[model samples]
Target: MADELVFSVEGPTATAARQISLAEAGFTERAHLQEWIIQNPQVLGEGVLIVTFEFDRWRNATGTAERDRLDVLGIDRNGTLVVAELKRGAAPDTVEMQAIKYAAMASRFSVQLLAEAHSSYLSRSGASVSADQALELLRTHTGYTVDNATFRRPRIVLVAESYPPIVTATAVWLGEMGVPVNLVRVQAYELVGTAEPTRLVSVSQLYPVPEVESFMVGPRSRGDSEQDVGPELPEIEWSESDYAKLRALPPKPTVQAILDLCSASPDTAIGLRVIEAAAGRTVFGARGELAGLTMLVKGRFKRRNWPFSVEWGATNGVNQAHYRMSAEQAERWISSAGNLEESPTSRLRSQEINDFGSPVSPAPHKESGVTPQ
Candidate 1:
């Protein structure tokens, strides 16, 4: 057992201390810890982006009649696949080798394969998401595209409450040789008090100490002759005139309101609903659907002969149409549009629909004093 965590009240004088024994923590059970990690993956620490867990079960290629399961599969900020294995108690001596085998199998995964796996994971959770949607979410969350070259090599992470001396030494040696393997020790502690029970867990990286120099291995080949690079999507580029037109458009009330909200703070993430609500009314008139808005925006951009295009794609978790404009272009458009002063009743109806979270509501043009064309 590891050392127990002690908690004491912070005061001028030391009060009675509450000792939390690791042995008494229920998370010491392997299954419990696994579930906890699955539910709260941030416990793995920063930079780890969880794509899916219990990714899949596979057997060795040699027909050895042995099969294994990967506890958690994800990608890091560097776009490298991460194979994480979890154990509540002391990790076995062969844990490093086990993780290596898992990584060897996982390294062959392409962006499509990962997207499919993630889609399945989401389906099991009752989310009817497609593989493309999952891939888009992955890109948004990690800010790393799955098709990046770094994903060609996979990394291994071993997580346990404790690692035996032999396991630590082997991990150190492997890391020194550039095997991209890491060890994380996770332990739970209970904060006992007169009120209710509270538990705290700590995750610490143990191998390849930050201060120590260690050899890191280059990307490993998946032994496949053909690489699946997935789709080659085109990047959107906006011309100076396109920026000017988008900024100078006579701001309709709906568009102005959205711009005001978005431009109020430079750091706020523009929500999908805000964009959808604004685009629905401003671009396609108050009665527009997402599909219609997509066509209208695309058509408008095309008619202008702009260098950029408005394409419909999955963003965050929803499918919507957005311009392929640079951040600066988008900011300028929002800020400049905010300067316009107009508040039409049709725009108020659009805002009401957005505020009420009802996308199917009929536009109240008649009641809003706007004659239906």
Candidate 2:
């Protein structure tokens, strides 16, 4: 990030932009800074997609938790929610803790809530888009979908004019602990012209400094249930109780429909991207459901806590984990899922195939032994 800017006059006179604090420039967090990020998200990081700002929708049904709002909610290319806390001036010591809390709360949000939030943001911002359109737009851009999806773990990005030493220390510690918290410092410069003044901003990463290799790749494709670390299990048989839990799991109509297509060739392991395209969702959308399925079986089977579908274990050496089972198992699981009971409330919601029709056919898939899976 640039510290200062130099400007030249048409004549011989030249001038340099003055450094200033955001407060000194009278720029506020919500009005100026958040809007800037919302308009141009590249300032946050490469491929960081915005979901909404001022997100206060985490449910507090117990009436205990505070309705604190996160400033800018977004997603990294990997589909993990980017919980950004913005401070116009220096960030306080508790900022890291605050952002972590928001990230934790965000895990409870389902695909619908995120789409609704985005739709609300678009309408309020004068786009006049409905939830379905917002869902489709999000799916098209980021591969995120409302069908049978849950948000992957959220990644934290804290932006401020400056961060106090304690704040950065905590943020660094969180990053080291694999919490995915990042600190970005914004520098303010005033470009003084003969006619008017223009404020310029430059951002430089702090916590996950250039050396932080772990964060460079973005978050792994894992769901909230995978947070509980345990030993690794290559394969395992789920108990009958495992099937019951799977049956009781929230119905993901769209993901299941996509899997129904995959069931046609169960022995072959499909690439992660192919399945994502067929579902009209990003890898994160469908993968979260798959991860949840793996976790459910793990919870019942008490295996190593790594993601493993009862149908098949995760294929290694890939950015996103892909599982394969005998075509029979694939068909059995999805076929049974379609029969799982939906409560009256859930049945009322239109099935997951609203914007997109039932795919005429499944996307292409490679043979399992042929692929890395």
Give all candidates' CA lDDT scores: 0.56, 0.60
Q: For all the candidates, what are their Cα RMSDs to the real structure?
A: 15.9, 15.3
lDDT of 1 by residue, 147-266 (tens): 534565677889887888998988888777888778988766666554766666767788757653234434546872222222222234544455457546654443443444444433
What is candidate 2's lDDT per residue for 1-373, written digit by digit as tens? 6544645445787777778898888888888988888998876777777888887644354434455777888865445677888888888888888887777777656555666788898888888766555654554444332232335467888888888888878877777787887788888878766577787777878767665663454555556345344334335453344444555667664345444444544555544444555555654456456545445544665553222232211233222324345655654554555565532322222222123322121132222111110
TM-score of 1: 0.55
Q: Under the 3 Å rule for N, CA and C atoms, how many clashes does model 1 have?
A: 2
Off by over 4 Å in 2: 1-14, 61-66, 144-152, 192-195, 212-373
Looking at model 1, residue 366 earns an lDDT score of 17
Name every residue pair that clashes in candidate 1. Answer: 178-216, 178-217
